[model samples]
Target: MNTDFLVIGASITGINVARELKQRFPDTTVVVIDKESGCARHSSGRNSGLLDAGFSWSPDTLKARFCKQGNQQLSDYCERNGIPLNRCGELVIARDGDELSDLDEIQRRAEGNGVKLEPVTARQAREIEPRARVHEQALFFPSSASVDPAAVMRQMEQDARDAGVRFYYETSFLRKAGDEFVTTLGTVQAGYVVNCAGLYADQIAQQFGFAGNYRLLPLKHNYLESSEVPGAFRTHVTAAADLSGSYPGTQIFLGVDGKARLGPAVKPALWREQYHGAEGFHPFEMSSVVTTGIGQMFQGGGEICRACLQRFTGSTHSRLITAGSRLVEGIRASDYRDWARPEIQPQLVNTETHRMVSDFIVEGDGKSMHLLNTVSPVFTCGLPLASHICDQVAAATGR
Candidate 1:
């Protein structure tokens, strides 16, 4: 075999997997490939750029366990390598009486998952952010942090390169040629392959006949920038309320650069992994913007519904709407100069059942392995997950 392992994606997942493999087996030859000319062209590069100290996961799952560990690991890495990371923490604000109950439930989940969370009064939340308008209560997690996603991804690429792992940019894995894989440039004979192909992971897994269990449902997450909060403290903020019945809740955030932004409204898309505005603006991208606005309104409850209705009507939704109204006070929706485009994230939708895979899925029979639906905090849990994947492969191969 020309190489011991071939990782088909250069995002955080693929690069961290390669890094772990190299650390475990220094003699093994590992190569990483990405269709883009550089790493993190998709979800990894475009995100809220938060470290996510507080994650929502069942206690028994790998996501819950690894998320906390990964948060610490990622923060340590940033500090060691001089990567820019903001331990800004996160505040889940409760805007109404009902949201207080949701905040309490989140606190219970966090405690069970071994994550630290504290209930704070509106006064305390105001102390954290004088401009924050949490009318009822709030949940504060001091461990949450944010980082420049692009910087962290670039650092991972540099680390992998320094560790002697080969990387090929503008290269794509076309298909499987018997037991070996064929790429656009050449064929690579490898003993085993790892598919961390973020948005298209399921497609790549099908080439190896291991993707029968799941399919990729691409969701477009959009972000609207804010100039209202200038030089704000480095802290990630979110809504404690269940905004339109989504998992992580509906929320707005401030990046490490101190720019507030809202969005990442989940809208289903037909294509597998399509990023809006990467090449040019498309009209279809606006379809989900309205839905996202509606979701935000629902999360805000009755008090904000009128504002949501007004802003979403006519061509106002087509262009940037300044966050001037009482619904999104202290935020100018117009401050969002341009859409940061859309990020194509892979959600595990079971083809047979036609339902979303609520949990992470890993399938293999010892010699080879495939990771499907490694979304969200997967980047945070990459190192530990890589170790687990390696152990699984070792048990299968008796390596």
Candidate 2:
């Protein structure tokens, strides 16, 4: 197969890049390929679907800028395409005076970043979410929204097809054969290549001598959707901090389909694509919510997760443990039936620093662009990120 631009990985980033290229250079031929059978099976489909309020990072960071603009861009995309969106907003809750201080810092950061954060009193927070354990205060992000990422990617894929972008699924991009890529299905030659390959992006770019020392580490996360706990959540409520500051903070989501979900315990996985069984991927226990923070859920960490819940939030309603560090009330633990769709993200580890790389890493000049760490809420920043990456490719390759 031959095209002007070849995009690897069928995630939202790749899809957005393809479409953007087509829109900019309508005469240019764009071809996209993915290792998966379908577009959204991997991390793109398995996330909490919360568009970051554009408030989580420092104002100077790239994450803060893209996320702030990306949230609104995506909201507009959903509106134009009939994709479902709940602009119900989000709440960052504080458990006590200590956590409330964190909220104050977050508000300062948000104001600096030009992201709107409204402070609410304990009574106001309870009015917003009665079940939420609001202690001293809560910050409301009015621009935040709950989005179905899988739906967004699906729509992008369709729109790309309509615009003449070709998709080759189940296609593995092997080593480069001179100026072309040798794939399992066929040989692909293009003026430029963009690798949005989430998990193996660094490896692909390494072949072209980019992304100097980044290696992917699997961060496994799973959620338990209660069978009996009715979807009672109105707005998205999440914790203020991860405490350890290692992994992500717990955020509870009420799906457009009427299911409330908590968790996504973050831990390292031995293998990227390997799953032990339902117990590992789909644990269905009440106490399993807290199991992720202490250790692996498959081990005896369920009690630890439960213990953390009792210790921090002071509530065991199954709905509130991962929500934050506050003592929430009104919500009770119900019988949880099974695990929701679990996902593992490619957490880029700087081999030299031996730490998780939080920022989006882009390498390559005009010839190729490799997007490493395009995970999670990156979907929120897809449109602009795609535009920026494509512009780089355009400049580098003179396309």
Per-model C-alpha lDDT, please? 0.69, 0.71
| Cα deviation of 46, candidate 2, in Å | 2.7
Displacement of residue 88 (Cα, Å) in model 1 is: 1.4
The clash numbers for all candidates, in the given order, read: 8, 7
Candidate 2 per-residue C-alpha lDDT over 77-146 given as tens digits, one digit per residue, 9 for 90 to 100: 8899998988777778887667876777778878887998789998898787777887778888888887
What pairs collide in candidate 1? 321-333, 321-334, 322-333, 322-334, 323-331, 323-332, 323-333, 366-396
Model 2 clashing residue pairs (backbone): 95-326, 133-328, 239-324, 290-305, 291-305, 366-396, 366-397
Task: Flag regions of model 1 displaced more than 4 Å.
Answer: 232-234, 243-246, 277-328
> Which structure among the candidates has the greatest TM-score?
2
C-alpha RMSD (angstroms) for model 1:
6.2
Cα-based RMSD of candidate 2: 6.5
